[model samples]
Target: MSESLLRVVPTVPDWVPAQDAADAAALVVSAMCPGAGELVACRYAEVTFIDQGANFEAVGCPVCTAPLDGDWWQERMDDAYATRFATLDTVTPCCSATVSLNDLEYHWPAAFARFELQVRNPGRGWLSPDEAAQVSTVLGSTVRQVFSHY
Candidate 1:
């Protein structure tokens, strides 16, 4: 059976909050998603990719707004992976503009983060902007949510 995930990540890829902040944020998430089956707060030693899983649609150049080639994106991802995602900088295949992979416009809003808060099977849909802002305020960082089904 498919599982739905509500994944939240900080806007800054390398940012990880204090343990107390993470704990508080987890509690707030639990209260916000009361119907969720499981909630996990993860801290990574290095930045990690957070994808939208089966919800992925397409990626576009942030500069030109042209659709980026999947193969080309894969190559860049591979290169970034070589450094364990420490460097996301690349020249856009569409516009030749230097940009960070983190800046790419992912349709499903994938991201890189050293910290993640995940709610599995949240009975409700996406979080509203105000809810996100609340979480962000508690965590002391701007955050983005990614909805995933897999």
Candidate 2:
């Protein structure tokens, strides 16, 4: 894991603007919790934008306990729509699940593209030895990924 460092603030850096970030944050908060009442109920009062380059991970909320992976797909879509980041080179079946209120469905196509996810840990989570192999394999892609962790 990489150690967190304290340093002087940067005058100029590669980043999106503060206003844009607030707008983006608003969009995210709204989507996650729709309706004005919910908006008022939920706390999105302060949105902090810390520059954690390359390695970034989302911590799940306590109530819904939704995994950050839930947002990962939409984030990719946003990248395609907003930033036009490229997709993985290969899409392989990683996991499967069924979602239903009344009827049960089987055999859902829940796959993970083993493309350059960059796999930067950012020192937040520890990477197991086995996980490191998978990360290495991702780094071995022949084609260049649009969003590079480097």
Candidate 3:
């Protein structure tokens, strides 16, 4: 089974009613991706904190585009779970550029949420910003995309 997923999650601004979130998720699945029916399976999931485990395997410094080393990886991952909007400061190994951990791109296997509208097996698929805005309009909250694999 393919473990890959492309998820849509609202940045939990405050406590959203469960019914509203579910309704918005259904609408997002139906309206966001026309080909989702053929290319992916959509579902709503209740996110558990334990499931916050790392989904992405590789991370690169956004400034220098250098792959982060083990030390940086360990430290960042540790912080990610401990804090909201986790960030770290370190020098890029490739170019010695000072940057924050938030300035990194995580590749496959990255985890991005505690609650999600999951699109399974979305091969090279993405939800556009306009689509996310549509979801936001419906949910009355900001929505963002997160990619991952199991």
Candidate 3 stretches with Cα past 4 Å from truth are 11-18, 33-57, 63-66, 79-103, 108-111, 122-124
Evaluate all candidate structures by whole-model CA lDDT and list the values in order: 0.93, 0.26, 0.56
For 1-150, candidate 2 gives per-residue lDDT tens digits of: 433311111111122224443344334333432322222111122221222334334333223434434355445335433432232221112233222110111011111221112222232232344543332333231121111122
lDDT of 3 by residue, 2-44 (tens): 4656666655522243676667566666665554533332332
- TM-score of the candidate numbered 1? 0.97
Residue 94 error for model 2, in Å? Answer: 18
Instruction: Indicate which candidate wins on lDDT.
Output: 1
Pairs clashing within candidate 2: none
Count of clashes, each model:
0, 0, 5
**What pairs collide in candidate 1?**
none
